[model samples]
Target: MTRPLALLALLVPVFTAAQPVAEAPVALDGTHQVDLVSEVNGHPYRLYIAPPEGYAADDTTRYPVLYILDGRRTFPAAVTARAFQDIYDGLDEVILVGIGNGEQTFDAWFSHRWRDYTPSANAATDSVVAVQFSQDPETVVSGGGPDFLRVLREEILPLVDSAYRTTGDRGLTGQSLGGLFAAYVLFEAPGLFQRVGINSPSLWWSDGETFATEVAFAEAHAALPAHVFLSVGSEEGRSMVPPMERLAEALRSRGYDGLTMDAVVFADETHTSVVPAMMSRTLRVLYGRSE
Candidate 1:
């Protein structure tokens, strides 16, 4: 209490500077990243998971989680687009998990997806068409849909649910072949996901095999208890629109009151360039945020 004048003067600057430096709060945007790795059916998968803001504070709160195929390249845009939806339109925020095909480069991803997303093509027929020198009737390096679906249903979904605050509802998003896989899932394992976004699905795959399957599937089930969003870019090609329309028509004809469907073709958009807008619209639509 009896400090000298010199000591008292020195303590003033120390006290001011010691006030925690008043750092600028960092202005965090409330985002976090987590890596989930697991082995499924002899293949290893790395999933990038982003839980929405306020995920951790309440133990009782749960949100729907979306599973994205081709997640390595697409997850960034998907999450950002969802964020924009949340900010601008007050959309319900959910968890985003992208399943990457383990390819860090472009070419590898193409080949890898062909093997994982397409339905199993007959080896005998493939040999004949492949010999034509014109082209193989069978898809190249294709036919792995069943196994990949197994991975999603058995391994990925369970693990993600255990780790994150996910609710009973689930959503799926994919493009092209991945979209084809989503289409197959709509029939093969309809109960797995409540919302599905199929973008420019390669209905051309396996010589349009999915069309026949869709017809059969709709015939069997009068009302599918799920929401479906189908999208294709106007400039993709003539063939793209018809198959998608046909599938939509097939589903609608079922007269299933539980089924909700929306099909749109964004004008002036091409295959490669359509993902961003499609992904954004998909989030808004399937997540019930669309105006």
Candidate 2:
């Protein structure tokens, strides 16, 4: 049926307006990206920086910096989680920094993470990972965590500190392999971060060498002055849950002074699905304001 001329004209404009139009991408407010090449590790990294609401350049307030691993995926999640907590739970405001390898593809990012997160090289594990990803074992490089930590300490942290108004208080959080790196940092340089979140850490990495690191830390120090949140999914199976529980127990058994540790096993969440809950709870435990 043909419509009247006036009706057709009105409908035409509406339909035309409703059609899809290409527009410039909208960026998150108060967020920016910085590309950095680490002098310590010679690895290029992309940092996703998000300042707290009402942050101002001239403001005297210096916020704590929360460094998140796997920034390509976790940065947005961390930002959302923090924003929600800030609104509903009275969470303290802090700067969020996401450390990414600057890769755009999954395989490339995976390769970088595999190289950067492991503490020791294991040919067996490398073969297993390569098979899982359908790649050659020799191509999968493992163990550059010490150098990665050096990159953060000598390069990333210093850059972030100089670029922003930040306090000495720092928090670090990572999941899976990234979590393993966080644990490594905890034992190797506990003083670098005041708060840490180890979410579903791949403690199985390198024959559970992180356990040995923990032992070394215990031998060297009588006290651990840090707030640590350790969490895992109940459904993550033997590889994840038990080691996390064991680590928690071992840390508790030491009775380390000034150590505020909170460990939880989230019900029915899988390794991949537990991240949102892990990030949310980690923020609350690590950054919640005192009432």
| Strongest candidate by TM-score | 2
The lDDT for every candidate, in the order shown, is: 0.79, 0.90
lDDT per residue for candidate 1 within 1-291, as digits (tens), equals 557887899988987886555667331255434444445557567787778865775578989999999988788888788777677665676888888856766556765676678877546644653465344344445577888888888888898888877898999989987888899999889778999999988887667899888778777877688889999998889768677777878777778758899999988999889999889888888885545
Clashing pairs in 2: none
**TM-score against native, each model:** 0.80, 0.92
Q: What lDDT tens digits, residue by residue, belong to model 2 across residues 136-182?
A: 56668897888998899999999999999999999999999989999
Model 2: how far residue 110 lies from native, Å: 0.4
Lowest lDDT block of 10, candidate 1: 25-34
Highest lDDT, which number? 2
Model 1 stretches with alpha carbons more than 4 Å out: 1-40, 122-140
> What shift in Å separates residue 270 of candidate 2 from its native position after superposition?
0.3
Alpha carbon lDDT of residue 126, candidate 2?
87
